[model samples]
Target: MSLLLLVDDPARPDVVGLRSLSDDGTLLDSSEVPTDALPAVARERADRPRWVWDDTARRYPPLLAAGVRVERCHDLRLCHAILRRSVYTQSSALAQAPPGPWDGPRDPAPVEGSLFDDVGPAAVADPLEELQLQLAAVAGSDEPGRLRLLLAAESTGALIAAEMHHGGMPWSVETHDALLTDLLGPRRKGGRPAKLEALADEVRTALGQPALNLDSQPDLLRGLRSAGCDVESTRTWEIKALEHPVRDPLLAYKKLSRLLSANGWAWMEAWVHDGRFRPEYVPGGVVTGRWATSGGGALQLPASIRGAVRADPGWKLVVADAAQLEPRVLAAMSGDGAMAAAGRQADLYQGVVDAGIVETRSEAKYAMLGAIYGATTGPSAVLMPRLTTAYPRAVALVEAAARAGERGDVVSTWLGRTSPRPDAAWQAELAAASAEGAGADDVRAARRRGRDWGRFTRNFVVQGTAAEWALCWMAALRRRLLAVDGRPHLVFFLHDEVMVHSPAAVAESVAVAVHESAVEAGRLLFGETPVDFALDVVVADSYDQAK
Candidate 1:
């Protein structure tokens, strides 16, 4: 049984409508409650029904704030996005139907104040109609079970996101402050850090322009040019190659400047609260089904400040990351036995080296990444033939997707997240390239454009599937940890790495759960495929130790 919840207004609800439905779509109960009493109602039932909501982002936060936790939910907005675009379920009427409010931006402007401060009207009715459509689409898809799994995993991710936000990532404000001070010098009120200011002085002195403002790109570029340095951009790599006294200082200034702007004292004040950094994570935010952070730069946490991520007094942080996840996913998806055999090793790249396919591990990595990312030249391109010969099936899978993309065709992941087709402008360019009077340069430009989009699609299939595997991994680990004693909870999650805050006594249990969950995730994604998704797991006091 699942309880369908309908929201009339996101900011506040005058009444909360709940409809209980059986698996066969029969409505068992229908009732309404005031916004304040809804949590109590939800918690009254021991075997809580799976809450079906239009958007989890809006509803779950308030519930979590009220000390209520939902075990399962069917997020309609997420499922609708998947069903409408997925090629596997396109035959269903829901997929074929024209866009409506359901297809709009899944998240509205975030609620600003108290969760239930703004009282609004009751919802008109249950959103069973939308839920029914999603259910039908999944049941009628080409791979019903797999499509169902994708939806389930995606919704679980939403629940996890909310829960993780409620139990914010453990952060040490003191440590972070100390690190900032050490790296950037003492904080100044309404002024740049001491170290950054000093570097700026070095930059200006090197360029022989005391009045130069390093913050302004145009001014910096002009200063560089006037200093007898031939440079077109202020990019770090471009700056590094130049033979100028300004080069080193300018580079140092840029690095520290970025650090100051992105995660400086102001960032800490705005984001970190109660010794926790609660980044707003948006699941399925990326087109490849990857998670994205709407705030706090969660996805882009730099290694420089990671030492600040410390555990509590009696707890340990179980940090774990999938080893060679994407390549292993490629091997399993392509069913390349030889590639899977290589994945069995602790270091897949070194295994490739041991196989005599590449002289060094670096070459093995370049060739594999080159194959997936579409390297047309350089060392990657030079090593491509050998890698392709070594793992023919894996290389062929990406090539097939690339060719499909070149023809403006869409490709689907293992669980059916499809690549979007080329837009109108691209189509026009491709047509012009093939036209009878196409110039040599025009042909070359069009070829380059095709290959660029081709690279995106080539990487999409593997990357998207790898993301699905990650979601499943997290889901399994979440469930396993929930059943164990000691309140082990996931505190942080990047793409392939997750941190679990656990009692020191149960840290061993958390580590074991993480290892077992990796196996379970692989099994769930590619059953019996001769692939091992190895993990580098460590029970550490801080995150850096695991790395």
Candidate 2:
């Protein structure tokens, strides 16, 4: 594909600059065009050039709003971040270069109008230079092929995020309001809901403190202690362990309180607009490579209000989530054919039971999670050895990652997303543990911190690889959907699940495409790997009814 580098002039809001780059990233030509004519310029191009822009959120939304979608693009900021920290590209000029304008977050608010009108703070990073550096970094990397694949998938993910924002999550105001009313009892202008107030009263009476402030943790804890209850904190789980009489009402209060605060009437009023929830998704937001949303709580939408995610008339929501994604990725990464076989015929846990690795599915789950998460106590720890003994290849991979992390070394995911070095505080703890004057307490603390970080890296490798798989899945699924009729498009994406809004007539075909795309994604990541990325596909009018 040809390359078009977009250059926005902050000083002149009416026109924007564009440059064409050669295959080797050499600038071939430059031109300026009217800002409002961008859509026509893009639409008239027979080449359908891959857009090279400083930030996707800033540049892509307006084109999408104008009804023009590009097939591919290189996102400078996202790729720069990857190459800057990536171990594979450390020797390249890009990684060795000092921190510059591209080192921080891109402007938070995306440009929804003329791109130049919202051009932020006089573009400090030159797109042409940045693209040259990124290309050089990838070409010189240890695993050029893997890094290229990763960069492409990462860029595609950015486009998807922008597209999803433009095409917002389907939301129903009536259903949302009704759910709030049914659960919390009526909206209030400046007061708590009736049910919540009733619960608070019950809590106060049970605690024997009429003036208790349940909202304040210290106040609630002091009130509990004052009422002759032995409580350390106001955490619901800790409260659940208490045998005191106030336990029931207090737990109920906390549960209802969370519902009221997170997805309450106020939240709905702010997030839901024009029958859609348009969250600003921050792609590659988490270090482990999972996505995070900057707004609308897209990742943390609680079950209580999912009913509001209803399909529009003549359309259906196609929801599909992978089953045991991390473990499946782990098996493929480790080349553990036995572990893969265990999940071949049934749910992975049930397959583990049938294979006699563990007596029950619960034990299988705990043991598998423990192995991946570095669990050192409780049932997970106790069951881990048996699992390790049965699945040596898989367990060894994570165990090796843990040991590497304990030594403060960086570990990479299957596709080479390297972890950061241990922080200064962690280094200090290690030094203190080994210094001549170190005491038993110092050594014990260091040991604990080492294990904690070890657990993090152990999970990071599998989890990060799983995230890569998911991005690949969405990229593949998006391509498949683009070919289908009725404009099936992805509207919501959690870590391992995707929700597509499609015309009701093509919902079944969309589901099939979803399954095919999962297979394609698995192939793209681990070619011909036997591990299954099985999905639970559903077609529903409302998200809450999918399960």
Candidate 3:
């Protein structure tokens, strides 16, 4: 008979086809082994039997063949190691090994460091901590039910601030201080000519009382001006001044002749209370490394809100915007002659059409945009072929990059911000499929999946480059705002807009700063690549009024 060697774990409940050694050390199948002796093999107490191949028998040998392999000896440590590596490598099948002898102890944790070691605790109050405190205070109040409503209001205000800041205003302590001073108004050196005194003659003439003194009505006029209602207007001011108060609640109508006109004071008081003069911010709001607002519509500030964003006494707000950012970034990345040429000219989409890439400019625009953005469905997919034919270099570059991504490699932004790679399971699946039969549909599908991964990889480069441009723009604008000695502080930011609270005096200068910053940001990002970033800016007393 041929000698057969078998290595099996009796302790394993799934052990089948296993045999035992007889009393004289002769191997026998489970059927031939005595039933009472089964416990010895099953309990793994008896010495495990091993079969050796007998070459002279001229029959099937059972020792490990040329390629066939199995563990020759029981090694709990080695088995656990194999299992761990299999798990780490994300192998399709688990290691054919037994469990560890016992559960392992916990790993040691890393030590924590103080914030001062990194950013220095001497820095300004932590924005996150401040926000947490504010939130806690609001949440812990007697009216806890109002927390959501309060948060919503706060978020709206933050959005407004972000939009305003995005306009290209600088956010700094000095600018904020200056803006606060302007909003509060400057103190007069000498006793200023009271508004009542200035309008004393007009009041007397309109009221038909030549000798009437109106020294007590200056607050009313100041309040009217603060509400944005012109105190000198004839329709509201003069007409109202002429009407005498028929009854005075405090005087019980006994001094109707002495009572002054309420005029627009009531409306002004209400306006001041309702209008947003200042908004709050929550700096670290976005999970994807972006800022978020706690108050104000930072993401969607209305033009009317700009009217409420007045600058400080002598400072002004500046704003800027980046132009055709992503397309230019794509042109640089792909090095597509047609795309480069399109970018060189004013309109990139038109250039693609002019190059005969597409029948119409709209199609060219959509296709080009979709290509850079990794769009693969519907209309975007339909236009891909034309794009590929027209700019093979660009197509190939992104396609190759995407392939790399599918292979579980990390993709980098233009500035070297690398995306996290796919996990081990993904790598194992791709690797395993790559080794499978050629021409098989499964293999083809795996290759296609890899290509799809590459597309994502390619788009990341362009998108990341665009994001860098935005950051550069923000940084440049921040620097420019700092250069202006006393301008409106940047109180908000959106993707491409900035908002500043500044005085009317420096509004024009702030706008200029914003424009210059955009040009500078472009130069810094692309290094004089005939591309330009232009902005449209408007300045007013309030956020709503800015255009």
Using TM-score as the measure, the top candidate is: 2
lDDT of 1 by residue, 294-384 (tens): 7889888888898888999999999998999999999999999888888899899998998899999999999999998999999999999
Better of 1 and 2 by lDDT: 2
RMSD to the hidden true structure, all candidates: 4.0, 3.5, 28.7
Task: Score each candidate by Cα lDDT.
Answer: 0.86, 0.88, 0.45
Error of 3 at 140 (Å): 50
lDDT of 3 by residue, 31-132 (tens): 323333433433453343322211111111111122212111211221222122221222212222222221121111111220011121222222222223
Worst 10 residues of 3 by lDDT: 53-62
Best by lDDT: 2
Q: Which 10 consecutive positions of candidate 1 have the poorest summed lDDT?
A: 111-120
Candidate 2 — which residues are off by over 4 angstroms? 109-123
Q: Would you list the rank order by lDDT, best first? A: 2, 1, 3
Models 1 onward score TM values of: 0.95, 0.96, 0.44
Clashes of 3: 56
- Poorest 10 consecutive residues of model 2 by lDDT? 111-120
Candidate 1 stretches greater than 4 Å from native: 1-3, 7-12, 109-126
Question: Candidate 1 clashing pairs?
Answer: 14-120
